[model samples]
Target: MGLLDGRTAIITGAASGNGAAIARLLAAEGASVALLDIDGGGAANQAAAISDDTGAPVFGARCDVTHAADVEAAVFQTLETFGRIDVLVNNAGILLDTPLPGLDMTAWERTLAVNLTGPLRFIDTVAPAMIAQGEGGAIINITSIGGSLGFASYAAYCASKAGLMGVTRAAALALAPHRIRVNAVAPGIIHTEMTRGLYADPAALAEITAKIPLGYVGEAVEVAKTVLYLACDLSSYVTGTELTVDAGYVAQ
Candidate 1:
């Protein structure tokens, strides 16, 4: 049997890239999935594609996770369709690469809203249902290595992710009594559509990859597998941890 057999999960920002990878992997491992994103049509398309590939029930809904009403409505819809939510992956985020001295306040605020507040909104909306079920659950936040270390052009993103790490720890404590586990995954230099532009410049990509012990960038699937481990029973004893899937980049 698959690790997530007979389970149901909700994955935010699942229209493409790492979010899409997680959705596909979870569904493959026997979980019915709900793909939530602000991009309605794109999410629908991804849902359809995954359902076709895995022969598992997959649903899609338009949800701006930073908005309370949108997150609440999406949670309700997920419950109505799938009965219960076994896992929640907060994978939605935006990057505002600006130096602190000349950074735009507007961009900083927006980054925090999507990267940090979005996860809080989801946890608040879903945790109650998870508690009521009494079956326990998992919450996986997609943070970045930027949170752990400072990068030159990623001030706002780093700050938001660092805040998310704090949220992960706090949520883990709050939900432990309910048997709900909360954790975060910090990925570094992953090859996703979001970072394709950087890779387009061969020298830049090489320079970045050189810092990693693995000597290469990671794939979305690699990150997805780590997420799956956190979501499954294999990690029953694990909680309030940050799993760094950074190819040893941070070790240097």
Candidate 2:
């Protein structure tokens, strides 16, 4: 039996990258999943692919986590189909590179909306459903090492993620009484479409890789596995924690 068998999950920003990877892994472990993304078509297609691969019940729909109506609709659909919501993965995020000399104000605002507040919007929606279930659940937010490491030219992204850390802690305490657990996954230098551009220049990629004690870039699956631990009983006693999957980058 898999760790998450008979459970249900809602994963945001699941059309591609880390979100998609996490969805696939959880479904493979026997959890039903609702994949939500701004790219509705892509999310639907990915749900089809994961369902085919795992034979797990999966749904996909358009959801802009920044919008309350979208989050509510998606959760309603997931509950209607799956009967209960057991895990919520807040993985939908955006990173716009606006340098200090002439930082784009629009980018700053948009980044906060998507990366920071978006997760909060989801938590406020999903937490109620989870509490109603009476069995409690898990909420995992995808933070970044940048939230602590402070990458140049990505101040808004960093600040938003750091803000999420605060959200995770506060939510964890508030939800603990109900057996619902809240946690954050902080990833470092993962090579995905969202982060591929950061490594496009060979010299820059090389420099970043050298800093990693592992001497290699990370993968989406690696982060997914960390998420799995938090999503299932393996982490039954864990909550209000920021687990770093950063190849020891923060250690230095």
Candidate 3:
């Protein structure tokens, strides 16, 4: 049997990149997945591909994580389709990289909305149902090393991820009694479309690699595996923690 057999999972921003990887992996492990993203077209395509590959039921829905209505609707749709929610992975985020001096308030707000408040909104929408199920659930937030380590030109992204960490801890504590586990994954220099622009600059890529003991970028599946572990029964006793999948970048 697969690790997530008979479970239902909701993955935000699952159209592509790390989120899509996680969705595909979870489905492979026997979970019914609902792919949520603002990009409905991409999400639908991803869902179709996963269904074809895994022969598992996968659904897709458009969601703007920052909006309560969107989040609520998405959660409701998942429940309507799957009957119950066993896991929630908040993986939707955008980098609004800007130094403090040149930072735009609008960009900052957008970053916080998607990176921080979006997860909060999803939790708010899903927590009660999870509690009602009385079987507990898992909430995995996709944070970043930037949340803990300061980086140049990433003020807003860093701040939002840090805030997400805070949310993870607080929610973990509050939901423990109900058996709902909340945790976070802080990825370092994962090769994704989000980071493609940065990798375009050789200097930036070199600078990022220099900090990692692995001396190379990580892959989406590596991060997805960590997320899968956290979401599965393998982590039944784990909660309120940040799992850093940065290839020893934070060690230095």
The alpha-carbon lDDT assigned to residue 122 of candidate 1 equals 96
- Give lDDT tens digits, candidate 3, residues 1-252: 999999999999999899999999999999999999999999999999999999998998899898888888998899999999999999999987678787799999999999999999899889999999999999999999999999889899999999999999999999999999999999998999999986899999898788789889999999999999999999999999999999998888
Compute the lDDT for candidate 1.
0.94
Cα miss at 119, model 3 (Å)?
0.3
What is the Cα-based TM-score of model 1? Answer: 0.98
- Best by TM-score, which number? 1
Looking at model 1, how many pairs of residues clash?
0
CA shift of 109, model 3, Å? 0.6
Off by over 4 Å in 1: none
Tens-digit lDDT string for candidate 2 (1-252) = 999999999999999999999999999999999999999999999999999999999988999988889989999999999999999999999989978989899999999999999999889988888898899899999999988877898999999999999999999999999999999999988888887776778988888889999889999999999999999999999999999998999999
Residue 49: error of model 2 in Å?
Answer: 0.9
lDDT of 3 at 67: 84
lDDT of 3 at 235: 97
lDDT of each: 0.94, 0.94, 0.95
- Cα lDDT for residue 84, model 2? 96
